[model samples]
Target: MCRSKIFRICLLFSAGYPLFQMTLRLIERTFYYPVSEPVDTFTILDLMFLGIVLAAFVSLYLGREYSDGVIRNKLIIGHSRMSIYLANLLTVTLGAFLMHGIFFLAMFLLGRLYGLPMELGFGELAPAALLGFLFIIAYASIFTMVSMLTASGSVGPVVALIIAFFLMIMGISIYSALSDMYAEIPPELLADPGFNPLASRPKWQQVLFPLLYNALPSSQAMQLMDYVAYAGAAKAGHLSTVVIEPTVFPLLAGTSALYDLLIATFTTAIGILLFRRKDLN
Candidate 1:
C-alpha cells in the first residue's frame, strides 16, 4: 500500500503540475492581471488544491480498507485497533508529506524556469514552509478521524471532502475579515479621531478573530502563500502597502505552528478513543 500509494501521489502531481502551469500561462496570455510569473501564479495552488487532493486520497484510501475487510482481518489477527489507527495515521501523514514535497519542488523548478522573482530568502521561506507542513499534517489527522469514524466506505470520502472544503472556506473567510481589521485608517477617518472604527470594538473581539483565524489550517496555508506573494513583489521592488502589509509574517508563522500542534493533538486523541470502540461488523 505504501509503495503504490506514494507512486500514485507522485504520478498525480507529475501530471497535475505541468497542466496547472499551462493553464496559468494560458490565463496570463489571454487575460490581464497585475502579477505575471510562474511561482507567483503557482504558489497558491496548494491553498485549495492541496485539501481537495488530500481529501480525495485519504477518504478513498481508508474507505477501501474497510470495504476490503482489511481492518477486520487486522483485528482478527490480534492487531489492536489503536495500532491500526496509528499505523494508518503515520502512513497517510507520510503520503501527505510526499505530495506536498513534490508540489513544492515543482513550484521552485517552474519558478526558475520562468525567471519568477522570489523576494524571501531561505530564512523566510523555510519557516513558512515548516508551518505549512504542520498544517498539512494536522489536516491529515482530521481527515483520518473522519474517514475512520464513518460507517459507509462509499460515504466516508464524501463526508471527509465536505469537511475539508468547509474548513478551507471558513479559514479563508476569517483570514480576510481579520486582515480587514488591520487595514490602514483612511485619511478622512484620521481627521475624525472620535470616529475611530477599531477603537469602537471590544478588546476580546480584536484578540479573538486573529487567534481564530490563525487556528485554522486553511489560514496557515493562506498565510504561507500570501507571504510568498508579498515576498515576490518585494523582491521585484514593487511592494504594495495598501493591499497587504508583510508585517504579519512573524505573527502568521508563529500562530500557525502553535494552532496546528494543538489541533492535531486534539484530533489524534479523539480519533483513537472513537476508533477503539467502533464496531467493525
Candidate 2:
C-alpha cells in the first residue's frame, strides 16, 4: 500500500489541499469581506470530497490485489478469509486516519501562522475529531465491502464511486428538505398568533428527515461541518451569536458517533460473511 503510486498521490493531496484551502480562506477574509471577520480554519465543506477519494482508493487497491492473486495467495498460506478482509479494512482505515491527521495538522499550523483564533478548545474539538475518525471508518467499511464483493477489479471503482455520489445526493436532498421545512416565517405571518410552521408538513417527514440526517454518513459529515462552523463563529464573537447550546452540541456529537459505529460494524460483518461464501475460481 505504501509503495502504490495512488497512495502516494493521496498523501500529497491530503497534505496539500488544506494548505490550499487555508490560503484561499485567508485571501477571502482579508480582501473580500468588508468587515474582515476572523477567518475560520475549519469550513463546512472540509471533508465533503473525502468520501469519493477513499471510495476510489479502496476500490482500486482491492481490485489490484484481486487481479494479482494476492488474496488467493493469502488463503493458500493459511490466512482465513475473515482475517484477510479485516486486515485490508484496518490498512485502509489507518490510511484514511493518516490523511485526516495530515489535514488537521496543516489546518492548525496554518491557523497559527496566519494568526487566526483557535475557536474550539480541546474539550470541544476532541469529540468532533473522534466523529471524523468514525466517519472514515464507516466509509472504509462500505467501500471495502463493495470492492471485495465485486469480481472485476476494473468494475469495483466504478460501482463504489456511484455509491459515494448517491450518498452525497441523498444527504443534500435531506438537508434541503429540512431547511425548507424549518424556514422562518415571514414577519407578517408571525404577527398572526395562530401560525404554526409544523402544521403544514406531514408527520412522517418531520420524523424521517432528522433521522436520516443523523443516520447517514454523508449527512453526518454535513452536520459536523455545520457544528464546527457554528462553534467557531460563536467563539470569534461574530454576528452569528446564537450558538448551539454547549451541552446539546456534545450530545449531538455523541449520537452521531454512535450512528457511525453502527454503520461500520454492520457493514463489516456483512462483508465478511459474504466474502466467506465467495468462490475465488
Candidate 3:
C-alpha cells in the first residue's frame, strides 16, 4: 500500500474531473440548441470514467509485483497470502471511494458555477451512496482476484477493464428493457390490438426484472443516477417532474447492497483460497 502512488492516482482523477465537466459544458454550448437542460453531473458516464481509471490503476499496481516477483518474496518472508490479497483489496477499495469523492467534490463545485441544483438531498442520496460503496468493494474484490490470477503486467488490467465495461453495458440494457415494462401505456395505445405486446409477456418476465436489476451492481449504479437526477429536479423546485415511486429507492438500495456484499465476500474468499495453493513460480 504505497500512499504516494495512491495519491498520484487521486491527483490524476482530480484533474480528470474538471476536464469531464468542461467537455459536457462545451457540448451544451456548442451543440445543444438553446441549452435545453442543465448538465447532468450525476450520471452513468461517471461510472465509465471511474471504472476505467480504477481498473487500470489497480491492475498496474498489482501486476508490477507479479512481474518483479515481489509477491513471491512476500510469501517466502512469512506474510500470509490472505493478508497480501486482503491488503490489496482494501487499498483498491479505498482508492476507488477516494476517486469518487474527488469527482463529487468537483461535481458540486461545477454545479454551483452553472447555477445547477444539487443532484440529491441527503435523505434521498444516502441509500445510493451506500449501494455505490458496496459496489466499489465488490469491484475491488473481483479485480484483485483477476490481478492475482494473471502473471503478466499488461493482461490483468486490460481484462478487468473489459469485464467492468461489459457488465456496465449489460446492466444499462437490462434497466432500459425493464423501464419499458414500467412505463404507463396510454389508453389509446392499449386500445390498438397490435399494441398488446407488453401484455403478452410471460408473468415470470415481469417478476424477474426487478430482481435482476437489484442483483447487478451496474444496474444499481444506473438506478442511483436516475434517482439523483430526479432528486436534483425536486431540489430545484420542479417537483412535478419527479415521477419515480418513493418506495423504489429503499428497495433497490437495500437489495443491491446485499447482493454486492455477497459478491465481495465470495470473491475474496475464493481469491484467498486459490492464491494460497497457487505456485508462485
lDDT of each: 0.71, 0.76, 0.69
Best by TM-score: 2
Of candidate 2, the 10-residue stretch with the lowest lDDT total is: 239-248
Q: Tell how far residue 216 is off in model 3, in angstroms.
A: 1.2
Local error of candidate 2 at 102, Å?
Answer: 0.5
TM-score of each: 0.82, 0.86, 0.80
Residue pairs in clash, model 3: none
After superposition, the stretches of candidate 1 with alpha carbons farther than 4 Å from their true spots are 2-11, 22-38, 117-126, 187-199, 202-204, 242-244, 247-251
Point out where model 3 deviates above 4 Å.
Answer: 1-7, 19-36, 39-45, 117-127, 184-200, 237-247
What's the true lDDT of residue 241 in model 3?
29
RMSD of candidate 3 to the truth, in angstroms, is: 4.7
What is residue 280's positional error in candidate 2, in angstroms?
1.1
Cα RMSD to the true fold for all candidates? 4.0, 3.8, 4.7
Query: Among these predicted structures, which one has the highest lDDT?
Result: 2
Instruction: Give a tens-digit lDDT track for model 2, residues 1-96.
Output: 899877888889877877887777677767785445443436323467668989888998888888787787888989999999999999999988
Candidate ranking (TM-score, best to worst): 2, 1, 3
Clashes of 1: 0
